[model samples]
Target: AQSVTQPDIHITVSEGASLELRCNYSYGATPYLFWYVQSPGQGLQLLLKYFSGDTLVQGIKGFEAEFKRSQSSFNLRKPSVHWSDAAEYFCAVGVREGFKTIFGAGTRLFVKA
Candidate 1:
C-alpha cells in the first residue's frame, strides 16, 4: 500500500517570504512522487515530480522538491512566495506505470499582503 501525508493543514505566509511545505510518504518500493496545486475552484496543476535520477527536482512557478529516500520525504520549497501562489497543495505517490495514485489530504497556503 502507498500513502501520502501532509502534516500541515493550513499555513500562512507573508507575501515575498520563503515557504516550505512538508510531505511524507509510505510505500513498499521506489514510488513516483508529485506536487500539485489547485486554486479554490480549479483543477490541479502539476508543480513537480520525481521518478529517479537527481534527488532534487525543479518545478513550475519557481517551485522545487527534494526526494529523500532515507526519510521517505519530498518537501516542496520556494525561495519567495507571492499572493498569487496561494493555493491548496497536494502530495501524491504512485507506482511506476500504475494508474492508482494516492494523494495527501492537502495543505492550504494563505498569503498575506
Candidate 2:
C-alpha cells in the first residue's frame, strides 16, 4: 500500500524565519503529492500539490514544494513564516485510478515570536 511519512512530529520556527517541512512517500508508481494545512479548529486546506510536469510547484500563502522522484520526497518550504501559519501539516499521496489518498501522521508547526 502507498504511504506518506512526515519525519518531524512537530517543529518550531520563529516568525519571519524560513520554514521547511519534510515529506517522503512510498508508492510503486508515481502518485500525486499534496501538502495540506489544518488550523486548530478548521478543516484541512490544500497548500500545494505535485502531480506531474514541473518538479517544483508553488502554492498559496507563500508556500512551495519540490517533487524529487529519486528521493521520493515532496518537501514544503516557505521563505518566511507567520504566526498565523502555525498549524498541523499533513503530507498525502493519492492515486488517480482509485481516487484514494493516504495522509501522513502530520507535523505540528509552532511559530514563536
lDDT of each: 0.95, 0.95
Candidate 1 residue runs with Cα over 4 Å from true position: 96-98
Worst 10 residues of 2 by lDDT: 93-102
What are the TM-scores, per candidate, against the unseen true structure? 0.96, 0.97
Count of steric clashes across candidates, in order: 0, 0
Over 4 Å off, model 2: none
- Per-residue error at 57 for model 1, in Å? 0.4
Judge candidate 1 against the unseen true structure and give its global Cα lDDT, from 0 to 1: 0.95
